[model samples]
Target: MSLRVQQMLGYTLLSAAFFIGFFHRFAPATFAEPIARTFDVGSTALGGLASMQFWVYTLMQIPAGVIVDRYGIRVPASVGTALVGIGAAVLALAPSFALAMCGPALVGFGMSIVFVSVMKNNAIWFTGQRFGFITGCTLLTAAMGSIASEAPAALLLRISAWQPIFLALSVLSLILAALLASFWRPPPAEDCGQLTARNKKERTKIFGTIRSVIARPQIWLIMLAISGTNGTFYAFAGLWGTPLLVHSFGFERDTAALAMTLSLVPYGLGSLFLGQISDKLRTRKAFIIAASGASTVAWVWLVSAGSATPVVAWICFVLLGLSSSQVVASFAAVKESVPDEATGTALSLVNMGVFLTTAIVQFGYGWLVASAGTGSTITGDLYRIALWLPAAISIAGLLGALKVSETFPREQHQNQPANTQMAIRGQLQPPYRDGD
Candidate 1:
């Protein structure tokens, strides 16, 4: 088969892997209450469970990056899929809450390997210029997975038990894992050869690659932006948004779920469209600033407007979705700033920071909401209070955008010579530059 065909097939299969991987993480949103009820645990305990998952992710990020760079994605990803499958099965059979925690913890440890590995592979396969759009599309894929867990998963749970739902997921996960192991190929041998330097002075250790990311001031800024964007969204989406809507607007759970789904649908679409625009425009900062700024405004309006018409709520939700995917800028900025040698590490570091903030913010948002009381009058007030959080984080991140000096230049890397611009597994591999 042609290299392009092979690369496309590989990416498609990887995307499927991503879908299942994310489904396991976000599936908790739909199952949280049920699991808690069955186990006699509270929301706080559930948050602790989720935190354990993130902690595994935090610990695994750099190691996973190194694994991706050295072994390619196949080994780590196949292991991760098997872990997730096993974890899901264990959670399904759990007779107690403690046993259930084992399932997500194992799954989280496994996911830590898969997420960075897939993203690093994408960065290697595609050029920096396309990172924003592709990353955005990837985020959109995760969002769709989140959406499925929210409504569709709930539907399944109504007809059957959560155990059955997880069983089906495990089967799907196993099939994808097998497909990835069978078809997943890395970048071309030439590209891998390029990574090896004949002289000792020319080569840096893997730890050096990670240190390079840590040394960059701008990387932290990008992390801040991503953290704020993700933290606010995930924190609110699963726990508080439904209650806030129902309490404030008198909407039913089904209506609230539909509204939440509507809110996220735009994000998936926006990521793809905005990503393409970013690639064409060759400008990153303006998009990041505009998207975050719009989202900040939307949050403020949501706080002050009270429940108002359902139409108004839907509009605000869509705006939030559109702005959330603007995180493509964070991914694009990292790709633009880092050298190809260190790209995997840099992106994984960014992912670590983003998710760390997400896990924390998710807990904080819930605590703040509950502390304010669930009384009718308190719902809108509590929402207003909550709205400021993501806004503040986003605004701080905008300053990070100011620090990024790199831009996706109009000149195509394809115009460069074959040696400098090698094709990887049939696709063009972008040349390494520290910053430009």
Candidate 2:
């Protein structure tokens, strides 16, 4: 194959894994009611079930990064995809809630590696200038999975049992894994020699890279911003949003699923748009701030309106999805903040932040609802109360966005010595050029 065709094929395989991961990530939202009915659980328990994957995914991020950095993408990607397939099957066949819980945990563990591997793959195959755009494309692909998990999954649930649907997903995941193993190839060893030599010269150990990435304040700020925005989005759209609409706003399950699908469409499109725009403008911080600010405002509008205005609620959902697209810029900023060899680690750190916040928000929202003692008849007021947590999180993220240093136009660090690069990385607020 020609080089371009090869790159496209490899990227396609990697994106397939991401698509599966995202499908599992959000499938619980559509399945929540059925699963709860099957397990005889309340909102708190259901929330725990939904959040389980994220918790496992969050904890595995660093290890996944290390594995990708050390072993390269093919092995990890194929193995992770296969594991997801198994987990899905396990969940499909589970006879007990406890066993079903194991399914998400295993799926989360497998999915934890897929994204970092894809990010590393992009870094290897694509140019730095197109990084943001490519990352956006990756997210856009994953968003299709989210979209499928909503309306399509709901529709499927209408005709078929959830078990059969998940069994089908399991089969699909296994097929994708097989394709990955058969086709995915890393760059030629000779092609990577120079980059490896550079890293060796720097004596860049994995632990040292981890420490360096962790010590950078910009990474934390980026994490906070992501946690507040995208994390909140995941908390809602991934699980609670549909239920809130169904119980609180008097939406049918199918209609609620469609609404979440609408939100996800903008999220995917907005990521692509923001990635290209940020790349063209050569800016990241401004987009981050804008997205976080918009998300906070949307949350406030949602909480205050309290299902009294369905139109307002619909607008807030769409706005929240669009604003959460800041992740395209956020991931780009994180990539730019670190060295090439540390890309996987740095990206994993930021990703961990997203899932960690998501796990907390998902469970917390459920806990609040359960605490109200409303049982199956949770009221709009109770949901409004629970929503305040995410809104507060959005405000914190907005504040963090303000402190995130600009990372575009990375020319200044290109020619610097290794020591100078390290010094620059440590600076909390690097000086910016005019127009930055």
TM-score, every prediction:
0.87, 0.92
lDDT of each: 0.70, 0.85
- Per-residue error (Å), model 2, residue 370: 2.0
**lDDT per residue (tens digit) for residues 1-436 in model 2:** 7677778999998898899899999988888889899889976677778888999999999999988877778899988998898999998899888898999998999999888989988887776678889989999999999999988888888799898988887998899889888888867656664555655554447898789889878889999998989999998999889877777777777787789899999999999889999988988999999999999999988888864766677788999999988899999898888777788889999999999999988888878887885556667788777889999999999999989888873544669776666644443444543224
Candidate 2 lDDT trough over 10 residues, lowest sum = 426-435
Candidate 2 ranges beyond 4 A from true positions: 189-193, 199-204, 374-377, 409-436
TM match of model 2 to true structure = 0.92
Candidate 1 lDDT by residue in tens digits, 370-405:
787655336556755666666676677656555555
Best by TM-score: 2
